[model samples]
Target: MSTPDRLIEATRELLWERGYVGTSPKAIQQHAGAGQGSMYHHFAGKPDLALAAIRRTAEEMRETAGRVLDAPGSAYERISGYLLRERDVLRGCPVGRLTMDPEVVASDALRAPVAETITWLRERLATIVREGLDRGEFTPGIAPDDIAASIVATVQGGYVLARAAGSADAFDAGVRGLLTLLAPPAGTARHTDAVVSHHPAS
Candidate 1:
């Protein structure tokens, strides 16, 4: 990679591993194998480089999510695909993690990408829920935007729950619970029976 690319990638990794306060410019330079002069030459400073890295992460998150959301499937299938997709649960979310950082949340420039990414996800999911309601797949009482927000909340909160417990079971349980709620009444009965049968009364 070029000097700029290297710097941005390194910053991305550092940001993921360490929050904005924890990731230093020196650490970014070392991680990138670029000297101080090269880093400064390519960018104004740490903020500039970090912004680039954050934007890249945000864009990638949107693209990956779109793949699942846009795929050929019913609303439930598409949402489930997204919720159950491969993720480094123990590592938490790359873009969502930034929302926890005080520095990132405090700065408009830094926060914009993260905020936009989440808003986009909520909007996309809401659209799918709306479609399902129109098709009589989802109950009429359920609000698209509300359920969309809850879905995002469930995933993000699942990560927090799993990380706090030091196990992915918490995350899996949360997803399963959300799936149950999302499933139709008949579908929920089958899902419940399946789960009950699999565990076999402990």
Candidate 2:
């Protein structure tokens, strides 16, 4: 890879492993196998490089989530698929992890991508919930934003629980619990036609 690409990749990997507070310019340089001068030649500084890497990961995750959550099926099916799909359960969400780091959360350069990524994901998932409501696939009274936040929280919290407990079972339980909560009642129409409503839409 080119030096800049190498620098970005190294930054992402380091961020995932060490977090923003723990990673240093010298560490990035060493990880990228590039000299300090070369890294500085590309990025203005650690903040600049971190922003680039965070944006890259954000774009990748958005594309990936669109694919998984929009896959052919009822909304529950697609969402459950996304939740249950293969994962490094113990590793946690790289972007979500940054939110827990005080320094990363304080820096606009570092925090913007993390917040935007999560907001984008929540809106995307909410769209699926809205679609399901349209198709009469999910029960009413459930707020799309609330449900979307819950799903994202499950994944984020699942990782924490898994890492803390040193097992994927907690993650599995969290997802399964979500599936149970979202599943529509048997023989029930999920929504009414002509007056379908979830916060009056949008």
Candidate 3:
């Protein structure tokens, strides 16, 4: 990668692994194999580089999520794909993890990407949920926005639960539980079967 790209990529990894407070310019330089002169030549400082990195991370998150959410499937299936999508569970959600960092939360520049990514995900998911509701794939009583929020919570909270336990089982269980709740009444054997089949063993 070029100097600027290397710096941003390194910063992204550090921010995800170490958080804003834990990451340092020196550490970023070391990780990127770039010197202070090169870093400064490419970007202003830590916060500047961090914003670039966070924005990149947020963009990648949206793209990755959109693949599953926009794929051809029932709303439950599309959501199931998102929840069950491969992830470094122990490492946690890159953007969501930033919300826990006091420094990131304190600065609007640092927090904007994180907040925007989340809001975007919820809205995208809500759109899918509404589509499902219209097709009678889901119950009419449930609100799309509410279900979307719950799905986001489950994924983010699943990361926390998995990290705390030092295993991905909790994450798997959370997804399974949500899928169970989301499945339409058992009368539609195909729909129920598809949902059950997608869940990993708990």
Candidate 4:
């Protein structure tokens, strides 16, 4: 890859593995196998490079989620696909991790992508919930936006639980729990038992 690409990729990995405070310019240069001159030549500074990396990570997250959310399936199935989709549970979420970084959260430029991606995800999920409600797949009374926020909170919180426990079981349990709550009532259009049974805990 080109020098710029190398730098961005290295920054992305470093950001995921280490927070903004830990990912230094020297560390980035060493990880990318690029010298100080090359890094400065390709980009203005660390913030510029980090922004690029963060944007890339955010875009990738959106694309991955969009695929599952847009897929041909019932609202529950599509949401199930998103929650159950393969993830490095122990490593936690790349974008979600950024929110914990003091430096990243403090900077408007650095935090924009992360915030936007999260907002986009919540909005998309809300749309799906709305669809299900409209089609009578989900019971009435629950608000789409509220349910959407809960879903995102569950996944993000699940990551923290899993990382803290040094096991993916915590994450799995959270997903199962949420799914159980989201499953329609027993005799509803989308049977609760079938929906929950379809995507067994894994």
Candidate 5:
């Protein structure tokens, strides 16, 4: 890769692992095998480099979710696919992880992409729910915003649960529980015994 590309790749890895505050220009230079002078030649400084990395991460994440949410299927299929997409549940959201960082949250250079990525995701998920309601996939009373919020919450909380328990099983349980809620309402065959059992705990 070119010098700048190498630096951005290095920054991406560092940000995912160490977060914005923990990451340093010297560390990035070392990881990229570029000198301080070389890095500066490519970026004004650390913020410039970090903004590039953060935006790249956001765009990549959005692209991946767009694939799942925009796939060929009914809205239900696409939304569920987007929710259950493979992830390092313990590592949590690359962008959402910023909310926990004082430095990242305080910097518009870092925060804008993160905020936009999440906003886009929730809106996309909510739009799918709206479409599903239009197609009668859900009960009439089911609110699109509520369900969308739940879906986003489940994914976010699932990561926390997995991280707290130090097990993917915890994340699996969370997803199963959320998917159960997204199931069709009661007194119906769609309410499997297992799902019924999960409802009380959820």
Candidate 6:
């Protein structure tokens, strides 16, 4: 990788593993195998480089989510795909984890990408939920925005639960429970057998 790319990538990894306060310029330089002069030449300072790294991570999250959400499937199936998609559960979410860092939260410039990414995810989920309602895949009287917020909460909270227990069981269980709730009642126009069958064992 080029010097700039190396620096940003190193910052991204360190930020995820160590948080904003724990990662330092010297550490980033060493991790990237770039000297101090090179780092300074490529970026303004630590905060600037960290911003670039965070933005890149946020963009990646959006693209990954978009692929699943936009894939060809029933609304419920698309949502199920999102919830069941592979993730590094025990390590927690890269963008979501930043909300816990004091420095990251305190700085508006640093926090913008994290907040934007979350808002985007919630909005995207809400749109899918609306589609499901229109298609009769989900029961009526359910609020799309509310369901969207809950989905986001469940995933982020699941990560916390998994990390705390050092097991993915908690995360898996939460997802299963949510899917069960989301499944349409039996005898509906569309059967839920497919959805139930697709769920990963908890």
- In angstroms, the error of model 6 at 82 is 0.6
lDDT of each: 0.87, 0.82, 0.88, 0.90, 0.81, 0.91
Q: Pull out the clashing pairs in model 4.
A: none
Model 3 residue 191 CA deviation in Å: 5.1
Query: Model 6 segments beyond 4 Å from truth?
Result: 188-202
Among the numbered candidates, top lDDT falls to 6
Give candidate 4 regions above 4 Å deviation.
188-202
Which of candidates 4 and 5 is the stronger one according to TM-score?
4
What are the per-residue Cα lDDT tens digits for candidate 3 across 1-202? Answer: 8989999999999999899878999999999999999999989899999999999999999999999898987787788888887889989999999999999999999899899999999999999999988888887789899999999999999999999999888988888788878886555533545554655532
> TM-scores of the models, in the given order?
0.92, 0.89, 0.94, 0.93, 0.89, 0.94
Summarize candidate 5's per-residue lDDT along 1-202 as a digit string, tens digits: 9999999999988998898878899999999999999999989999999999999999999999999999997676676677667787778788778778888899987899999998888888889999978877777888788888888878788777878888767767777777666775554335334433432222
Displacement of the residue 22 alpha carbon in candidate 4, Å: 0.6
Q: What TM-score does model 1 achieve against the real structure?
A: 0.92
Determine which window of 10 residues in candidate 6 has minimal summed lDDT: 187-196
lDDT for predicted candidate 3 compared with the true structure:
0.88
- Whole-model lDDT for model 1 versus the true structure? 0.87
Across 21-63, the per-residue lDDT of candidate 4 in tens digits comes to 8999999999999999999998999999999999999999999
| lDDT winner, 5 or 6 | 6
Order the candidates by TM-score, highest first: 3, 6, 4, 1, 2, 5
lDDT tens per residue, model 1, 1-202: 8999999999999999999988899999999999999999989999999999999999999999999999997787788778877788988999999999999999999999999999999999999999988876776789999999999999899889989998878888888888778885454223433442342110
Q: Over 4 Å off in model 3, which ranges?
A: 189-202
- CA RMSD for every model? 3.8, 7.4, 1.9, 2.1, 4.2, 2.0
- lDDT score, candidate 1, position 10: 94
Per-residue lDDT for 1-202 in model 6, tens only?
Answer: 8999999999999999999988999999999999999999989999999999999999999999999999998888888889988888888999999999999999999999999999999999999999989988898999999999999999999999999999878998888789888886565544345554564543
